[model samples]
Target chain A: MQGTLSVSVWRGGEAGSFQSYEVPRRGNQTVLDVVTYVQRKLDGSLSYRFACRVGMCGSCAMMVNGRPRWTCRTRVSRVASSGKLTIAPLRNLPVIKDLTVDMTDFFDKWAKAGGVFKPTATRAEDFAAIRPTDSKRRHADAGIECIGCGICYAACDVVAWKPGYLGPAALNRAWTLVNDTRDGNGAARLRAVAGDDGCLACHSQQGCQEHCPKHLNPTAAIAGLKRAVAVAALKGRL
Target chain B: MSAEKLQTCLWLVQRISASVLAVAVAVHLITIIAAVQGGLTAAEIIARVGGNGAWAAFYGVFVVAAAVHAPIGVRTVLQEMTPLPNFFVNALSALFGIGLLIMGLDAVSILYRLGGG
Candidate 1:
């Protein structure tokens, strides 16, 4: 508690190396604060990403001590047991720089999962009243708050093994649309999340559920997708 | 059927086979335990299972379920861990599934024949 913390921050690109730094341990200091200190005081060339400094913004996600976490909210005291921390870029995605990863692939997978919703009605139609207490609406609401942090995608083993996998975040988003009664993209979206690289590829290991900072259960959403795809396949829609 | 359709069917088959295996394994283990309590000797156990229509039928179901389930699991693992293409992986996986069925059926037939089927 009184000594300087030994922090190993990954520097450079995908083929980069970890550079160790001695950062002063402070009371209630977050991991992002530690990185900032290393950047301002120790080294000027250090690169990391953070925006809101609060948990709301998903831009601050990084691998903190081997687990994907929002560095702005993650405290050094909570993660650094031995006063040592290893910070790196998110997994299952290409690293852009020191601690920043290329989110293009992540969002591309999101699009591949049919994350975008197609309206069942146009602006000419009146507001389609969907009851808040409806089962499908409730189901949609469960995974609707995803901030696209790419944390779940980083934690997924299937994504690690199978690069073609849509990962959890994309699948969870697809699930929200699958429940959206107003979303005209039903069978098409289900078909998108079907094949070997789709929702069926998930091993249901719940790694995404476990590491999700928002507490969103992608595993459950994926199970819903599986059932939906099966029904669609049976009905000859997929 | 399309590729996605085939993948979904394979997934369904794996799940259904897994359910079948769950029951079959439980029954098989329970029966083995019960029969063993009566004496686990080869002669005694063979006598209990021998000439039993119900036991043969149960084992036949087990063999079929296992044949379907295991190869799918293997195929998934191989697909994830290996860089093999779909065509090669599919052919090999199908052949493996067939091989399992052949081996499983052979065992079942032997058991039935020995049991005086």
Candidate 2:
């Protein structure tokens, strides 16, 4: 709501530079507002990805001041230090352009970890009546709300090191799928996540949990995955 | 080995070597720092190593442990950072571990025989 805010936005792909922009401050302004203003008014070439202007879409994630967050949810008032902010694309992914990372690798790791729900019963069969309060359902409930945001992925140091590693979000999704009573592929899923680049590789740095906007504990989910895999391996099913 | 078994092996080795190296390096560094701080002469150092069989044995263990430890760390770094072929990476790290053992033993020998400590 004052003179100007100093904004440094990443301008290229993986190898890029931060271009500085000055925008007039406004009240209750979100980080996405700042980026939008700079792109629409200041410079037309600046590129960033976002769908729903609200926080639900999870597409507006960027590294703001060295931490990945949803720009739509993160207010400038909360993050701006000395009225300056640095915005860059999510880390550990190939940057397609400024503030946009190619999520193919991230999503591919999800599939590799067997995140997809493999139903045990056909629709012709009776519908599975899973009590909402059941232990497995509760466990799945804890992680089922993930918005596919790459914030946790960007915050993870292990992913940076092991490029093949299935990241927190993917592993979290797998955990939910594992707990689904209808899922028939639990043993196979456990096998897939038991390998070198899978659930066993997580160092439990808690970076994913710390930076997740949804407050989802992917680390805990991953720990459960590890236990599940170990059990399956011991049982000779994995 | 199955991928799960391989991962388990790596996890076990890393922890075991880390525990061994922690004690060895701590004693080594503390000894060096204490010697320097006390202004102990080279002759005094030599006399201790030459006469103290226990100290020689301790250092021998330290050397072997370090040899086992450092290469595993380097191997982890290589695994994380580079796109080098897997077989070559494992081979090179094994060679490095062996090299460390040879150098460590050689140094211990020099300390015991030539230094007369």
Candidate 3:
């Protein structure tokens, strides 16, 4: 890893092509380090987004070689051991610039899936006691750590195939909200996610689960949504 | 019906029909293999199945389950793969299911009537 690495970075809008740049390889280099090298030294005009340079922000996600990955956490030695790398913007979203994608649609779908929590009780009414071992609480806790990184969205085939379909991350958020015992939007949320473009559209491919940096299972969350929708429909609630 | 309810009901119907089909297909395949292995003639097979209420019911259920299952799957594929309108897809899938049901039931009815039932 002592030689200069050949890196091809996407360099424009939707119709742009990859631009090659050579950067000195370091022993413990990340893909973000390569992009930063290109931006700071090789070409000052290159555009990309990253915060915290660690994995927490999830703002540095890009397609590494062909799959959606958080570039900040991905090791160059691990992905591009052959002294070559291809980095591009996340798929299934509009490219804003070189490596930046428009996240408006991603957030819009989250809203459509009722990802927001609807509180049932006021502060004056005292806190709702939810046991840690409660089945519903455990189900909610399982999917509560989503960071809205859009990696799951980028990795979902259903989202790529049907633009109207709410992707895995949005559906996963809805699942967590649905399982919240104190939430007041259960019926409406179930109805929202029961549509043709919602949970039913998922093929259970597990692409989101596989690509998730946090190892979260959006497929399982979507399955939970499907079951909830089915039960609500059967009970005449949806 | 609303699109959400329709989609949910279709999903339920497809799953239930698939369950029925799982058992029916196994039984149908086993019966076919047994008949072929025992060297039963077409006429002899007809004699055994024709006018038999139990066999008629079994085949009837099998045909119904297949009629329900295949068309829903086809509808999903059309919706996802093709650029067709939703209304057109629904109508086309419904017609396909109806056609299957009619043809399958007709075949079963003819077999039932062949032995004077």
> Candidate 3, residues A1-238: lDDT per residue as tens digits?
5799999999999999999989999989999999999999989899899998868877899999999999989999999978899999999999999999999999999999998899989889988888999999998898888877899999998888889999998999999998898999988888899978999999999999999998999999999999989998888887
| Tens digit of per-residue lDDT, candidate 1, span B13-39 | 999999999999999898888768656
The per-residue C-alpha lDDT of model 2 at residue B21 equals 76
Compose the digit string of candidate 2's lDDT tens values, residues A1-238. 7778999999988878999999988999899999999999999988899999887888999999989989998989999958998999988889999998999998898898888888889889998999999999999999998999899999999899888889999999999999999999887788778876888778899999999999999999999987787666556666
- Give per-residue CA lDDT, model 1, range A1-238, as digits (tens): 4789999999999889999999988899999999999999999898888889988879999999999998999999999989999999999889888998899989999999999989979899999899999999999999999988999999999999999999999999999999999999888899999989999999899999999999999999999999999998888888
**Candidate 1 segments whose C-alpha is farther than 4 A from its true place:** B37-39
Per residue, candidate 3 scores C-alpha lDDT tens digits across B1-117 of 777997899999899999999999999989888777557686777787989989999999999999999999999888989999989999999999999999999999989989568
Displacement of the residue A150 alpha carbon in candidate 2, Å? 0.4
Query: Candidates' TM-scores?
Result: 0.95, 0.78, 0.95
List TM-score (chain A only) for every prediction: 0.97, 0.98, 0.98
* Weakest ten-residue segment in model 3 chain A by summed lDDT: A52-61
Q: For residue A156, what is the lDDT in candidate 2?
A: 94
- Higher-DockQ candidate of 1 and 2: 1
DockQ of 1: 0.86
> What clash pairs does model 2 have?
B46-B117, B49-B117, B50-B117
TM-score winner between 2 and 3, please give it.
3
As for DockQ, the candidate ahead, 2 or 3, is 3
